[model samples]
Target: MRATSIILPALVTALFLPATSPALAQMAPPPVTDDVNLSLQVEDWVKAETARVILVVDLAGQAGGVNRADLLKTAAAIADRTDWRVIAMDKVSDSAGLDRWRAMLETRLPEGRLAGLAERAKRASKPGQQVRIAAVRFEPTLQEMEAARSALRVKLYARIKDEIALLQQTFPDRRYRVQSLRFNENSGGYRDAAPPPPPPFIPPPEIQMIGDPIRTEVIEEVAPANESGSGQEDKMIVQAMVSLGAFAGPTQ
Candidate 1:
């Protein structure tokens, strides 16, 4: 029998997928949930006072060996000596080379102090322990973010309250209460407040989040209250939704 090969033509068809991937699971947040909700964008308006000053200590491939732990300790000590407050000493992975020890410091000083802080840290380095300020940038502190979110919650609640009050006044008979509220961040995540809501009612709703593996709520929701809040300079908007799950019967 003659050898014959059957060539099957490849089928080429376009595959359709969602324009944007589905966001993470949504969840109700505390503090804000009690306030009310929407795909709302509230400005944190926090002063960009906080600055992150990163100091990197390169201990990779050196003729003079140094203990990694000691290097980190030395780096932290050096940061403390600077005008900045030492936030933490973190290990940064360098895929191209060995891991590096990074010291994170913060300051509320004027922007001009960044360069001086970097320079001072470099000058304070000891033998086999070189400290270099990798970067100095202005950002919001955890406290600032918390404050902004807190402010946003108040705003959301006020808006909701005004609307509900108006509606109740209009009806004059029906009673409306907030059943659930959710803020699903564009980052697809959110955080809850500490000291759980006073008990006696229902437990807080479960918050579901679908966001980047490394979630950053600050970058997601908070923004600096700059002069002209436009474009990239515009504040981050936290989107939320309110559920009026139950409506009591008309008052007798």
Candidate 2:
């Protein structure tokens, strides 16, 4: 009986120890429930600053109770981090409770377009469908969004520059460059705007061809220049060329 007790406890402990399976170790957590309510809170900092950070919260099942006060407190806790927008959801069965719930939302939502979102939430069916809200600043042009994204890129680049430098040291022969071009059109004659012309191809530098035995050069024909046009027009006909040599170089 004493041996049985000791063996039984050891067997139970071994059984409860974590199982090792390669497949189970790689699996991700289950997705959030479909009936979860979602809300957004715009922090003061986020409203004033550039980049936007959104918080997604789930209020479904008993993971958290479905009380309004509790939900509001949960939302407030999330909003304390930044000055951003908030989206909230409340479930109502009939018209009586819905009117009261909508009135509360009106008090929370800022005036103007945000109020419109609140109105949408009021009319949305509840009880079953999960509510979702998003907060984003209004920008007039694509340029503004691009500027924000560029700023973020710069910050990210700064943070990882050390790693990039280390990689460059590890691979000394490699070279990297960033190239960008822009095209603009001024109003002329055509009623319908035509697509921008294809970009001019620029050949790589000729220095790369050094040390080869058998040499080759690329030559391009040019068009004659008109006397009436500026001499600057002649430069456009100078075609780019690349020279290759027979010398073997180290493989990258």
Candidate 3:
């Protein structure tokens, strides 16, 4: 089944929210560092199934304009060339917006797929810094995971980094320092994916000797024991018959 993708609305910094500075300050710190942290988190948005990437950009201080529109445009352009599903992220300013956001996420990214992260995001946002989060769900077909990781994934991150760099240059007063990170979706931290599953197990074939009663050959020989010539030793050789029975395993 084609897994459903929940595209969250891109959020503006706390400056855009209606909350007072004190109230916004009461909110929890950003999930990532306050610096310009840009990373990708690939999530299994359908339980243990389909996966997608969360391109999170965290900035410190009151940001003037992060240029989300241009960032999104660059993402769409990259998607066209890479065939990845990249989308802009959205923010929630109040309880009503939060409710609607949760409803939309639950309806789309159902069954514990992405609901937890949404809640966490709500908690992590604070007035001290601005955080921008986007998503990219590459082709979920089983065969495309590798392609997504190898080609599309790199392009996705590069585009994001370029945007962040441009923003830093344009708004030097903001002092944006875009951090390069390797994101782990599970822990929501900077790290690579876990080791892959072990290879499939194949038991050895079960062989039973049958219809081979007539078989054995032997040879005997005498040899000197040692320089002392204490005694003579006998050497014996034995062989078993070669036969065939009902086959079970692959012959090729």
Candidate 4:
């Protein structure tokens, strides 16, 4: 029994002692800095002369273990591209920090349809999902967006020509020119229809034309003098002339 007790204690110690298995010995520790893999896909809106750059960050493995600063820094770094405006979504990170970052981005970039998009993202997300950042490059103006919509489904090559023609017509006097037009398969073609034409140009009532005043002409007539050679005749003629002048006087 004494021998058995000693052996049992030894067996327990041996079993409890750590063993260096190949899996543990060869495994690499995760990075200390919360480094997430970032993948970028750039799509160009050829007609709009804009680009949509999608920045997909892998947050699946980072659950409950991502550094806020690192994530934000990563986002900011990705946004640094000159041709892209970063739109962060699926951000399964610190909500407050993400909101703050979004606010800061709004102040910095202050462009595109980011406000509406951000609002939509915020509404869609649950409590804690990694924000997926979508960056738009070369965003189109209202006019460009309209043109793109109109030219939807036109082959990429043909779309450029159509856009140029439209631009020429829309801005007849302006010396606008399109240097190049690129197409991206990811953007899924231009929108089907152009946004409704800006409300027709309705002239203000105050600006309506006022008609010119009516013109008038006056005519004078004289009666032949009586054959009788008398002072009364002269007086009669003078009276007649005076009457004619009075009738033909400038109209009021």
Tell me, by TM-score, which candidate is best. 1
Alpha-carbon shift of residue 109 in model 3 (angstroms): 32
The TM-scores of all predictions, comma-separated, are 0.47, 0.17, 0.18, 0.19
Error of 2 at 212 (Å): 69
- Model 1: weakest 10-residue lDDT segment is 216-225
Clashing residue pairs, candidate 3?
9-89, 9-90, 10-89, 10-90, 10-91, 11-90, 11-91
**Tens-digit lDDT track for model 2 on 1-252?**
888988998877665655464443344332321121112111111121232222223333332335555544544443333333333333323433332121011112222223233233334424532222322222123454345445444444443444345545765654322222122222122324556874653444411111113433221111222111121100001111211112223323
lDDT of each residue in 1-252, candidate 3, tens digit only: 233232222244455665556656457432432344344433322111332434333323222434554444433332222222323223323433321110001011222233334334434445542222233232234443344344444554565556566766766544444344443322112224545774644422211111113432111111112111222111111111111122122322
lDDT of 4 at 242: 9
Per-residue C-alpha lDDT of model 1 across residues 1-252, encoded as one tens digit per residue:
233232222221112322342321122222222233334455444555645554445444443444555644655554443454454544444556565444333444444343355456667676645665544455656776667677777887777777678667876655667777776433211233345653333212211121223441111111223212221111435544775423443333
Report how far residue 180 has shifted in candidate 2, in Å. Answer: 9.9
Measured with C-alpha atoms, the lDDT of residue 240 in candidate 1 is 49
| Model 1: lDDT to the true structure | 0.46
Instruction: Evaluate candidate 4 by giving its C-alpha RMSD to the native, one decimal.
Output: 44.2
lDDT of 2 at 121: 34
